[model samples]
Structures are given as structure tokens and as C-alpha cells.
Target chain A: MNVVVLNEVRKGFYLDSVALMRLSREVAGSPGVIEAALMMGTPSNAAIMRNAGLLEEGTAVKGNDLVIAVKAESESAAREALDNAIKSLDKPKTQGEAQAAWRPHSIAAAVTARPEINLALISVPGEFAAAEARKALNRGLHVLMFSDNVSLEDELSLKQQARAAGLLMMGPDCGTAVIGGAPLAFANKLTRGRIGIIGASGTGTQEISCLISEAGAGISHAIGVGGRDLKKDIGGITTLMAIDAFDADPETDHVVLISKPPHPDVAKSVLERIGRSRKSYTVCFIGASEVQLPANARFSPTLKGAAELALGHKQIGADFDANAVASRLPRSGRGGIEGLFAGGTLCAEAQVILAAAGRKVASNAAIPGVPKLGVEPSAGRDRLIDLGDDEYTRGRPHPMIDPSVRDDALRAALKNRDLSVILLDLVLGYGAHADPAEHLAKIAADRGQDAPVLVASVVGTEQDPQGRSAQIRKLEQAGFIVAPSNAQACELAVAIVQNAGR
Target chain B: MTDQDRPQYQQLLARKVEVVNVGLEGFVKDLRDCDIGVVHVDWKPSAGGDPQMAALLAKLGV
Candidate 1:
């Protein structure tokens, strides 16, 4: 039944007028909400209603300053929703509450009477994510956090509280997660498959998710154990809990672990835990290449490597073929990779790969090598640009998702006559909405025969998919060479560039 | 990248260049004083708005 609860509406707080309009539009668009009104001010205040677009052509009220409305659903459901929304409202704070901008999307689970929801995937910004997480945990929900930039101390406290309550708390800077066959913010919706994911890196999760989807397998659940979750103080608490959850889940078959290299002690603890479980696991702790894992745990250098291992079939009679990876190798390119990525750790992994390949960086510390292995600042030099550094990426989408920087990066590559090869990475799957190759293909077309060899690696799956292969095929059709893996793409790009020079 | 250096970021602030902060009449006077190309601020929501204040900054051409 549709019932409106008017328990807690305070006046004078801004409802993000633009966001409110969008919410009203979504409501109006929905067949469920028969009618909606935006309530404002008390009876003693200035105006009964100021600028509510949700109001009918001529609806007016005299007594209570309530945003009265009817529902498209049975009155009981609508009324209950209104009641819940009102109850959630706090006295309009002087500066506005954190959740003010986001309209609460009522998932069917919110109304269900189940005491045990498998997961709560959250993506609100870092400032308020802890509170949201605490609220979810208090309600006995296991969390898949996607917020970044949260303080480490807060994450620790939240994890401790959640542990006390026997609930799982996933991320402070968590980026990617999948629950109940749905992709959360920054997730790849792939074709359904049996592989499961447990990651501490959002981008790492994104990379592996895309890779598996591309390999024709899909994730059952991709849990994010936020970056700091594996540290000594935090102690990999959430990762352990997620492992247990996936181990018990009937849907999950294989498990993939993706994260930045952890401390030795923490790594030891994680490896030990994995050894106890029967589920086969693929681990990609980027940069800690030489760590010895037990026989059951396979190690990969990159996120894609972990995914490739997870999606490949087990053979009846085969020597563990280390070099027989079925997926495309990173395209080889000429010139050292001018890595312009957002995350420090991803940049670190790229640099590690470049170093292992004997490539010299030409620029900055982050892109470090003898020849700099990165972009350097020069007076009046405009063409060879450097992004992915902290200076350029603030307040905007990361370099992977934002096409403007990618376009600019490509333009810089094109302008540099010395640049015989363009090395780029394509991150797909959830969290990002733009088609990755949409712009690169244009740049490739513009070059025609002269186009610098454009090589990239896409990370995602069909179940939580980002359509990277289609993007690669499009680039290939446009005459640009495409590689299957980041390593292969880098190798091919370097070769092409070297050949061009010769 | 420290907060202390924020005050030194005049170029960035200039690039962010809002017309209302520059003042409508004074800006127009300065433009006319210089005899440069004129610039107008149409502060209507349908055109370009800063709705919270409901103050429309307009530049009328003859």
C-alpha cells in the first residue's frame, strides 16, 4: 500500500535543486509513482510551495506544507516508501547532509523481510561512506564498498565494529564489486559465468573482471576489500571474510585475488588462509613477483594475468604451461611507454613491466627509468604531454575513463614525430561508462597509414562486460594493430615503433 | 600540492573566470574603455544561470 510518512521534514535545507529535479523526473518516468510532490517550509514559513515541477498543473494546499501525492502502485507500497524516505530525512543541516544529492533508489531488497542480505554495494563518496557502511552493517548487511579517499583510521574502526557485529566491511577506497548478479558503481556487467572475485584494488578488480568476461567466463561475485584492508592494523579482515563468503556461496567455483603488493606478514597470512581452502585461486599482487605461493595458488604479474589464469580450463594431462596463456599478449610498441594512468600503483606496475622489458623511461619519477621512463617538464614544449600525474587528474574522471585526457594524450602522441608507437591501456567493465576505443579509433583513422601503432589491453567479462574486444576489433578494422594482453600490447608497440625507425 | 600554495594559484583562478564576480557594469565599462570586443553574460536559466541567488547578470547590446 502507498502511505506517506511526514515524521521528519525540516525546512531551509537545500535538496540539490538539480538533483531533486532529476529524481522527480525519474519518479515521473517510473510507472510506479502515480503522483509526487516536493514538500518545503512549515505552515508559518514564507511559501507553501515554491518551484516543485512534480506538482500537477494546478494542485494547491492550504494547511500542512506537505508534498502530497498519490501513487501508481497500490497505496500501501507508495505510502510505505514515502514513510521510509521521510524517516530517513534529518533536520535540514545548515550546509546540507552528505546524502542530500543522492536520491535513495529503493532496491526490492529494501522492502523484503529477509534478515540476511548477501551484500550491500555502496559507492557514495569517501566522506560519508563509513556512516553509510555502518548503517548497512548495523542492519546486518555484508558490504561491497566502492568509495575511495576514506581515511585509514576510519576504515579500521569500521572494520573493527563490523567484525564485532560479525559483518563484513569491504572498502574505504574500494572501487569494483558485484553482488547478486548486478554490477555496482565502477563495475563490469559481464555474461554469467562461474568465476568469483575478491579484490583489494578497484582498478585491479576492474581489470580482472574485464579480462575474465573477455575470456568468455563471468564472475559470480567480485568483492572489494578496500586498499588498506590488508594492512597490519586493518589486518586483511574483510578479505578473509569475503573469502569465507565466496567459499560458502554455492554459485562461485574459482576465485581470483587482485591487489597491490601487500606487506610480507600480511601476504603470509593471506596465503596461509587460501591454503586452507579447497577453491583454486589466482593471485595478482602487482609488483611482488617473486613471492612463493603454495602449489594451489597461481601468481600473475598483472590483473589481466590473474583473470586469464582463472578463465582458462584445467587439463587432464598437462604440465603447468606457464607460457601457454590463451589470451592475446600485450601488443608490442616502439618507444618506452609514456604511461599516463591515474592510480599510483597501476603506474608502478606499468613501470615494472617496462623495466623488465629493458625499456628506458624518458621523463618523470613516477614513470621512472634512466631515460626518465616518464614525461618531463620542458619550457615551451607543448606537444609531448604528461597526464596520469596528480597535477592533471584532480576533480576529474581518472585518465582511463575520461576521454578528454585520452584524446589529448593521443594528440600529443600524434604531434610527436619521434613517437613511432603509442602505448595505451584500456580499462573496461563497470564504473566507467564511455566506450574506450571510441576516440582512439578516430585518432587511428586520422592517421590512416601513418597512425602510430596503437596497442591496448582491455580488462572485463561478458557477464559484467565492458566490450573491450569489440573496441579492439573496431581499432583493428581501422588499420591499427591490437594486442590481447597489456604485456603483449607493450611488446608489439615497441617493436612496431623500432621497425618504423629502422 | 600543499594548501598553503593555494593562494598563489591566480592563473587557475583567472581561468575559472566568472563574470558575476568581475561585476557587470564595471566589466562593461572596462571593455568599452579598452574598445575591445564586447562580452555579455546572459544569466537566465534557459540561457546560462546561477539560480540559487536568482540574480540575473545581463549585458544588453544596443
Candidate 2:
């Protein structure tokens, strides 16, 4: 009989034991059976063994506790294993359960059996992700985690485990990435080149990964450290590890770090860590630029600039001047600036910039929710809100994910008599659900002749060259002025309002 | 063995109902009831036919 071991398949959350035991007994007493043992640690695993009838007769082990063995030859045995495992099992556990597992093949085995598989991506749910991750690490495979909603506790623990094992865990909710010049889920494959990326934003990572590749640089890996890894308690655990890995990799030369604003303390720690590294670094923390850069680190006003600066270094007509972009920006009239963003970090950084300029912005607003836009006499406040915020978005794609939200807001902003200026973040890359250009075109088409909509975008070429170019072309064709950095967009928006008031 | 004369022969005949059967370790007793045929199918949506069903159908040459 040929024996096959199915690896990494796991019981979802809320596993049951009774049904499995009955199934186990059926398998054990089957004709032509040689021997089989159901191997598992969870309680429900035992039930499967008992039903297969491998349990010693008169043994005290209950169905859930029974561990049984059975033997059969060929594909029959393998099928029996799968059948006996899921018998009488009811509904799936919470979506958080790990419903999948992976089999580890040795390096030589992998090379021989799956030579074409240059990448290994993982998408098991959060609960059992760590164990499967461990198996991937043991096999020396690069892992891309698509599961989100993981606890910070599990994230830190798993990251530490991954680091020790010497593997990459791309995300807890890593929505997009490109590897070895190949498109993975939500990735746009482009020409490969120099800048390798480590980003907190999955879309941001996809954009930068594609940009670097488009700029004639190949990515060694685009590691996504999930949004929460840079928080105070987590302290950039995965980000730092990914950075070091990128630094050592011969395939990567430039590294870009993108995230929404983290806690001040965590930001400082991240800056310190980046400062210690010898590699050239470009950073775009969405809200505040709290941490001063080390000699090798450079800060950008937007993720777009960071990608360009990291990949092309100094390109002509590409404004690398930070203050220039800031100066070019239109100020929020003495009123408040209304900044509606889909990405969290973009909001965080915008608030920091506003506060530093002696302006106050509401973070998570509660009541009387007319979002502030222009400057006011009391204080120059900036309102940073997510179009994808729970109050506004759910079940629906976040504004950044889809452009229809932008058009709706554009119409609303144009109609508001009290509104000074409108601000938006347009993200483009692989895995992004909508095109920024088409969205901008809709905004341009919908705008009242008198209202000027200020547009800012974090877009680039590597992930989806055709899509990126198409979005840019569409926006340009619409006569809507586009800015590269979020700060620049804010400044431009404010300038338009301030100039109008004068 | 004629159906009339074979209770002992039926026991011997029943054992021949299956070909090779393999499962996890220790659950051999489940096979005691060889009266019914057991088939296994993968959980994937693409898996349409059970191994036993297919094998049985093939024997019928349908």
C-alpha cells in the first residue's frame, strides 16, 4: 500500500469531536486495511481515531480522545484519511480558525519537485497561521500571509518565531505584493529592477514593488509588516526584521518603509533602528514626521515620492525638494482643512503636519459631523477622516479601494457652500480594486464649474504598468491637477481656498 | 459456494468485498462491517466523483 501524508490541513475554529470518532471506527475495521494512525493534537482529532475503529477495545479513551491506526493501499487510504477527518462536522468555526495547513518539503525535494515555484504565499486564517508559518520556515520558503484580524499578541509572537527561523511573514492582512518579478494576489507584474520594498500598507507595497520593478530594478521580496506592527507595544517587530533581511539581500538595493503614523514612541524606535542601518532608506509615515532621519534615511511627503527617490535616486523634473512641495501647497484658509483619506497612515501624517503648523484636526469625530475644511479664527484645524471609516464604509470597498466613493464626495464637496477645499488620497497598484484615473475623471466630470477639486495620489508603475499609466493619463486628460505627495496635495488644496478668500 | 450453503462461505465471501483499504493508525474495527462500500472524496469543489463511485462505475464500464 502506498502511504501519503496530508500536511497543514487543520480543523477550523470551534472543532467538534463526536462525529470524528464514529468515522474513525469505520476506517479501522475496514477490509484489506493494513494499519493507520490519525495524528493530531487538538481534541476533535481523537474522535476521528475512535470512529476509524483503531481504539483498543474496552479502552477508556472517549471518541475525542481516541487515537487510532488503519492501513490500506493506494489513493484509497489517502481518501479515507480525509473522509474520516471531516465526518459529522458541523458548520465551520469562526472565520478566524485555521482551516488549512501546508506540507513541508525539503530544499532538495522542492527543487526537484517544484522547480518552477519560485515563490510560496500563505493565506490560512489567523488562528493557526503561526504553525503553518513555522512549517514554511522549516522548508525555507518565503511566506506571504493574507490573513488579517490577528491579535497583536500573536503578531509579535509569530514574528519573533519567524525571525528566529529566518523567514519572511509578509502580512497578517497583506492584501498585495509582487515577488521575483511575478504577480501574486493583488499584484501587477511589471518589468523588474533595483528597489526592493518593506511596507506597512499592502497597496502601498504593491505600488512601490511595481514602481521599483518598472524602474528597471528587480524585487528580491516585497515584505508587508501589517499595519499594527509599528505600534508602541509591537515596536516594529516585523518591519525591523524585514528591513534587515532586505538590507542583506543582494537583489535589493533601495528600501522603502511606508506606514500610517504610529505612536510617537514607536516611531522614534523605528527611526532609531533605520538610522543604524547602512542602507539607503526612504520613509513615508502617513501622519507626522516625528523621528529625525539618520544619515542614510530620507523622508518623503508621500509614498509616491519615496518610491521614486528610492528607485531612480535623482530624476530630472522630479521634485525631490520637501520644503518646495510644502511651499507649493495651498494653505487651509484660516478655517479647518477637510482631509478624507482611505489609508489610515495618510491621515495620521496629515494630522501631525497640521498640528506642527499650530492647527488642530479631529481624528475620530463623533457629533455635529460637518468635516472642517478651511481655516477658522479659533484654530487652523484639519479634519482627517477615512472615507472607509466605519461610519461611512463597510461591506463597501474603502474609498481607496474603489473610486466611486471619491465621485460621491466630489459632488458633495462641490455643493457645500461652506466648504473651502476638498482633499483625497488616490492609491494605485496591484490588488487595488479601482483605478485612480477613472475615479479622477468621474470627479472632474461631476465637479460644478466653480468648484476646484484638489487631487493627491500615491501611484506608480511596477505592479500594473498599463493600469498605472492608464490612471495617470485619465487624470491628466480630465484637466485635474495631480500632485505627488499628500502634503503637497494638502498645501495645494489650502492654497486654492486661501487664494479664493483673498 | 451456493447462496443456500454459504453462511461460513458468506463470511469468507464478504471479506472479498473490498480491495485494499488504508486509514490512520489503530481504527481497523470500522472495517468489520464490510456490507457497505466506502468512498472518499477530496474537499475541493473541483472534486466531483468519489473514488469508490468512480471505481464502481468503471467496473460497469459506463
Candidate 3:
């Protein structure tokens, strides 16, 4: 085999994981290419490139360097394949977008051109967000921060400064929000109405808003304060602000506060603030057990219940039949679940619920009982790993937007001899992968039906771009016991565990 | 926020929400595509996000 190693092919800039994977597929399928791989010069990536014979002696590259290694039938063919990989990586996301020269030079410059800009949507890398947010706040603008990887110190300082400056700093990692009926990053398109929501979890906010919109109640606004806002340090700064905004808005007749279980002090602070609310509000602290809320605020333990309580309506819950799931428990092999989830908050909720039910759970998340998968990768009787966590997606897109990493995780978990049930969450929406369940079907197809029962849920409505029914159908076809919600999916998994052939 | 900033609390709630997306210019495109007013911040992390914060985080053992 003839190998042509493009040493330090592209440097200074990084290709996103999606683009990297797409480039590899494109190059591998090109003519005369026996094998091809394109990756950054990370240690793991360098090892793969070297082992695959895609590297040459004295090839020194940094993590930022792009390495394209190709092997072909001949030297000329290898060079040609390498050339194709470069072209694919350099290709434009959209032909028209690349051709269009309407790109602005900077934020201050863009604001100068159009002074109507009241809000600045900040999605820069985590470290730079504080500086950029400072610039926006100085300009008397509100910020919707969508970047993560920011330090807790910077986050606290930024939020404090925003509050002092009289501007809203939505997130260092906030993913979804709707302001004045204008949907922001990773938000669903919904009609304007009276129900307003503030959540610390992006997907949790989405799940509730989508549920409300589907039940014939439109959303007035939804603000995401990020996952860590309710922690002790940040102390629910944005959450309190959002609640007051919803309280003051005449358009928002009722409101809801959704989140993963918050820090005790933060929760009490928020609860005391809610005690003073004049308008009706519901609190769905996702995985919290029963809590006595103030007279004005009702505690909802589930996302669906929060939506239902906010609208003063009821719908039949999709009860996961424990008997039905138990009937099909794996007769042999491991009997515990190893849930591989794509949504962090959903994974946290599952851990919280299972822990409350007295189930042994361990994970890569920060839940109390669930130890970090890094420190204890194999501690839990049931291992639940949130593939969307930063550890898993360091150089890749989120699992929701890119399922390759999640698929890889699932395949790894399936190899475990003690795995009797596999739990997953298929969160579908506009910005999510176009057809995840279609992809899930392909991933789980190799697993024999009797190997382990698959339990899952699709956190989307029928109106999503990826049709809910179609995705559910694909999952069902893959032998997944599709539950109605994340909580139900956990219940189904627990039941499967309880009845697994001992 | 500190106690003195209670008055500024009304500032964010009083105004209409406008977004300035810093990195990932695609987010600006997405908001604009949805007909929501948005602006790109053309961000490169004043100190490049990586070296400065990473060095600090490493030293602080965060």
C-alpha cells in the first residue's frame, strides 16, 4: 500500500468534529483510497494516525494541526486522496453563505450600523465570553450567552457585573431562550401566548415549552440561565431575574421555574423569592422529591406536570408498564442497566429518580450519588453516562447535534457482559441531529433483541423537524421500549432491572 | 448581584432583549433565520480563551 501523509496539513484553525467526520467519510469514499483518516494532532488522534500508517517519520504537529493520512493503491493515488481530503475540509458550509459578503467585521461595528440591536447573542468560546459580554454590557445591551467552558469565577463576576449594569447575562452556557417571542439558540419555534418559563437546563426548558405549546398553550417567553446557575456560587442570579421578569410581564399570566435539583441554599433563596410572587407559578425542579412550595408556587417533580399545572390542565400520562417491560428481561448475561444518555439534564434527572427509588446509579455527571465516570467508570450497579458532558465532547459537537460519539459510547457499553438493559434519550428538535432515531436504528441494529432490552424516550413534539412519530418508529423498530418521557424511561429501565433473569 | 444593584435589576427587565453572538457565528445566522434580530461579535477571545484561562485554571487547579 502506498501512503501519502500530509504532515501538518492545516494549522492554526480547528475543524469541528462534524466537519472532521464528514471529511474522513468523503476522503475514504474517494477514488483509489484504500483507507483514510483526518484528525487533529491530539495525543489520541496522533496515536490513531501513526498506527494507521498515516504518519511519516519526523512529523511534528501540535494539537491545533490537522493531519490527513491516506493509503491508496499507488503513490499517485495516495496523493490524490490526500488532496481530496483537504478540499472537503476547506469546502463551504453553504455555497450561497460563502459567496454572500454581508458578514460584519465586529460587534461594535455591527451595532454602529444598526442601533436597533437591543440584545447581543454571545456564543463565543467560554474564556472570551466574559470580555465580549463586558463590551456588550458597556454598550447598554442584554446578552444571551451560549458558550460553556467558562470558569465559575468568571461566571460569577460576569453575572454580578451584568446585574450591576442593569442588563441580562443569560448564560456562559445557556443554549435556549425566547425573548419577546424571538427564539434564540437551540430554541423551538412556538406561537406567542401567556405562559412564561425560566429554566437552568436547556433541554428541560425546551421539553416544558414544547409540551406547553403542544397542549394548545403558547409560550410568552422562556429564559435559560444555564445548568450551573442554581449552584451555590452563582446562586441562581439569572433564575431570580427571569422569575421577576415573568412576574412583571403583563403578557405572562402564569410562569414556571424548571431545573435540575438546585443547591439547597439556592433553592431556598428562590423559594423565598417565589413566596412573594403575586402571579401563579409552578416549580419543576426536575428530579426533586416532594417539597412544600409557598402558597403562590406549586412544586412539580416532572417536566410534564409543570406544564400541566401551569396551564391548569391535565392529560393522560404515558404510564410505562413495569410488567410489560419485566416480561422481556434478558434471560442471561448482566441484569443491570448501563444508560448512555445524550442530554445532560435528562441524565441527571434519571440519576435523581433512580437514586430516589433506591437504585444504584453512577455517572459522568455531578449528581450527589452519581460519581464522575472519570473517577469511577464502573462503580454503579447501573452506569449512566451523559455523552453530552464536556469530558465526552471536548473536540466534538454535542451528541444531540452529532450522534457519532454517542453511537460509539453505546457500542462500548453493549460490550459489557453484565449489561441487561440499555437506556437512552433521543432528544429531537430543530437544531438537533436531523434524524437521530434513524441513526439510532443503524447503531443498535447489530445488538440481538435478546441481548438487552433498549429503553428510551424522544424529548420532542410531533411538530419538530425530525417527526416524533418517525423517530419513535425507528427506535421501536430497533427494539427500544420507547417511554413517553425521561422519567418514564428511567422507570422502565428500573423495572427491567428488578425483573431481569437472575 | 449585590444589594445596591436592586435598581439595575429593572434595567434588563425593562428593555427588549437583543442578542450579540460572539463566537460560532452560526448562532447569529440561526437567530436571524428565525427573524429574531441578532448581531455577530467577531470574537477571538481577547487573549484567545485557550492560553490565558487554561494557564490560570491549571495554576489554580480548577
Candidate 4:
């Protein structure tokens, strides 16, 4: 077999990471291509290309330059793949071409064109995100920053400026929000109602909002505070602001706060502020032990519990019968649970549930009270993996955006006879993968009969671009027991594991 | 002054959301699909993504 490596660097050319990733995926799927990557020549990206063996030593590439690298079975294949990548990047879609003539080149230009624009969604590369966000804030627009890898100092500074100006700075790495019935990046289309969500975790916000919407209740707004807002440095600036916004908005009669365990001092101050609010609050700090809550607030240990308390009852019903489903499975002696999740918060929620059940849960993105999945394996220990964690998504798109990231892991877990059950989550929204369930269903269909029982849940609405019911139907048809919600998915997986060998 | 009058963010909840999408065109398409008002910004790294150059340009008020 002939092997060849080739690359082309286009000076002063640029595309956003998502477009580049899409282009790279297209090129990689070309005949005989082993691997392909289209990235800007930033130091970090260049390093990624180098580590992937796509770049030669001492290759001259600058940050503004576009790098297209392909390794293929032959020189002809490599050349063809690179040409196709370049062509794909150059070819403009019909709508984009029509709008290209009038699209603004900067935030200032955009604001000038639409002066009524009160919100700026910043999704540039992390190095350049803060600058764009600063410009947006200066223009008196609230910001939803969808880019990650931004420095801590920049986030702190940006949030402070937005606070002083009384504007909302949603994130430097914020991924989800639904403001005034408008679904922002990576959010479900939810009905407008009384519950307002202030979440530090992206998927936590989505799960709560989707559950609320599914319960016939609705969301006034689901504001993302990034992942680190409740840390000691940021001190819940956006969270506090979102709480205030909900408190003042007459449309919102209740508020739900969701996050991993926050910095103790920040949590205290945040709770104190929620205490002053006239509206009732449900605080779901996953994995956080019981603390003194404000009189107006109730504490929930899971995302479903948060929605339940906010709705004033248990409105979300069970999607499947766990005991009956477990009884149908083979009673294997092997008993280990493996959870592969696209949502980090879903993974954390699973870990919290498993930990509370006296099971030692290890994860790459472990919340408080759970141990990290170390390099050395612990025998018989349950593992929940957040494929959306930075380690899994360094150069590739997020698992929610590109479901292929979870494929190899899911396959391995399914084939592992040591596992009694495999837990999974399919997140659906505007920015998520078009049909993640189809991708997983195809893989699950290939698993042997003796393979572990597959239990899963979906965090989305029926109104999402990828319909939730359709995704669940696909999974269920492919031999998966689909739970209604993420928390129930974990419980169902536990039931299956415990029922094994009984 | 009441708490409602203290923050400008609260006022945002009462108004319609008109968005200026910077960096990603996909987000623009998503917002438009939902019948929300949005404009796209064809964003590129200023000063060719060089940190020093970008900082210099910022200092020069570019």
C-alpha cells in the first residue's frame, strides 16, 4: 500500500472552526484518505496538526493562514482530497452567496446595519473572542459568547465590564440560551412561560428547560452563565444578573439555578441574593451536599428534581418500566456500568446518581464527591465518560455537534463483556447533530446478542430540529431501552446492572 | 429605586431579541430558521491573528 502526506497553506484565508471541521470531515471521507484537517495556522492548531503528523517539521505557517492537510493511501488521492477541500471551502452556498454582499464585516458594522440588535452571539476562535465580545459590550449589546479556550482573565474582565454597564454577558464558553422564546446557540425551542433558568452548565440548562417544556410548563428564558461563572474568580456575575432579570420580569414567577458544585463563598452570596427575590427558586447544584438554603429556595440533587420542584410537583412521568425491562435482559454475572454521554452535565448527573447509590463512579469530567477516571483502571468500578470534555474535543467539534466522536467509545463499551449495561444520552437542538440517534442506532445494531443492555435518554424537545420522539423511536427500534429523561436513564441503567445475575 | 430599575439586563427580557451574530454563519441560519431577526458578521482575526499585532492595533484604536 502506498502512503503519502500532503498539505497546502493559504495565506490570509480564514473560516470559523465549525466550517473548517465540516470541510475536514468531507475531505477525510474522500476515497483513500486516511486523515484530513482544515484549520487556521494558530500555534495551538499547528501543534494539533503536527501531533497528528499532518505537518512537516519547521513548516512556515502563520495564524491568519489556512492549512489544509491530508494523509492518504497515495499521492494522487492526497492531492485530490486537498483539491476537494479547497473547492468546498471556496464554493459558497446559495443563501450565503446572496447574503455575502450585505453581511457586515465587524460587530460595529453589524450593529450599524441593525441598530435594534440588542444581543451579540460571539463564536469566534478563543484568542479573538474576547476582543469581539469587548466590542459588542461597548456597543451596549448583551453578549452570548459561544467560544471556549478564552483566558480566565479575559472572562473576568469582560463580565465585570458587562455588569457595570448592566448588560448580560452570557459566556466566554457559553453554549446554550433561549431568550424571550428565541433559541440561541445549542438550545431547544421551548415554549414561553413562567420558569426562568440560570445555569452554569450548558446541558444542565437544556435538560431543565426541555423537561420544563415537556411537562406542559415553559421557560421565560434559559440563560447560560458559562461553566466557570460560579467559581471564586468570576463569583457568579452572570448567574446573579440572570437571577435579577428573572426576578424583575413579570412573565417569570419562578427561577431554577443549575450547576456543578460552585465555589462555597460564591454559592453563599448567590443564595443570599435568591433569598431576596420575590419569586420562588429551585437550586440544583449537582453533587453539592445539603447547605442552608434561602427561605424562598428549594434544593434539588438532580436536574429532573429541579424541574419537578419548579413545577410544584412531579410532572415528568417515567418513559419506560425499569424493572420489566431489566427482567427481560440476561442475568449475566459480569456487572459494570458504562455511560457515554454527549452532555457534560448529563454525565455529571449520572455520576452523582451512581455515587449516591454507593457505587464508585469515575469520570473524566467528574463532579464533586466523585473520583477521576485515572490512567490506571479500577477493577469493577463504574465509569461515566463525558465525550464533550475538552480532552475528547480538543481539535474536533463537540460530540453534540459531531456525534462521530462517541462512536469508537460506544462500540468498545458495547463489546466489553465486563459491562452489564451501557448508558447513553442523545442531545438534540439547533446546533447539535442532525440525527445522533441514527448514528448510535446503527452502531448498536451491530452489537452481539450477549452485549450489554443499552439504556439511554434524550435531552431535547419534540420541537427541536431533530425531533426528540423520532430520535427515541430510532434508538428503541435498534434494541435500546430509551428512558424519558437523563436522571431516569441513570436509574434505569442501575436497575439493569443490579438485576444482572439475580 | 426598585431592583427592576437597577439592571439593564432586566429590560432586555421585555424586548424583542434582535441578534448580531459574529463569527459563525451557522448560528445566523439557526436564528433565521426560528423567525428571529439576525445579521451575520464575517469575522476574521484582526492583525492576522497575531496577539502582539492585535494588541498593537487595539492600542492604535483600529
C-alpha lDDT of residue A163 in model 2:
64
Q: How would you class the docking of model 1?
A: incorrect
- Higher-TM-score candidate of 1 and 3: 3
User: Candidate 4 clashing pairs?
Assistant: none
State the lDDT of candidate 3 residue by residue for A278-336, as single tens digits. Answer: 77889988767756688988877777678788878666244557668677655544677
Q: lDDT tens digits, residues A159-200, model 1?
A: 887777766676876666665444544666665667888888
In candidate 2, what are the lDDT values of residues B1-62, reduced to their tens digit? Answer: 44444322112111222211111111111222223222111111000213233223323323
Model 2 misplaced regions, further than 4 Å? A1-141, A185-191, A203-221, A260-278, A283-295, A298-337, A352-360, A364-380, A388-401, A405-408, A434-436, A443-446, A452-454, A462-466, A477-479, B1-62
Q: Kindly list the per-residue Cα lDDT of model 2 for residues A4-66, writing each as its tens digit.
A: 333223332222122233444455455545555443322233444455454445544321122
The alpha-carbon lDDT assigned to residue A299 of candidate 2 equals: 80
Those runs of model 4 whose alpha carbons end farther than 4 Å from true positions after fitting are A92-96, A99-101, A375-377, B1-6, B55-61
Q: Is the docking of candidate 3 incorrect, acceptable, medium or high quality?
A: acceptable
Candidate order (TM-score): 4, 3, 1, 2
Each candidate's B-chain TM-score, in sequence, is: 0.29, 0.23, 0.47, 0.68
lDDT (CA) per prediction: 0.52, 0.51, 0.73, 0.87
Q: Work out the TM-score per prediction.
A: 0.60, 0.56, 0.82, 0.96
Best by TM-score: 4
Q: Report the error of model 3 at residue B14, Å.
A: 8.4
Worst 10 residues of 4 chain A by lDDT: A369-378
lDDT of 4: 0.87
What's the CA error at residue A490 for candidate 2, in Å? 2.5
lDDT of 1 at B57: 16
Span of ten consecutive residues with least summed lDDT in model 3 chain A: A1-10
- 3 versus 4: better DockQ goes to: 4
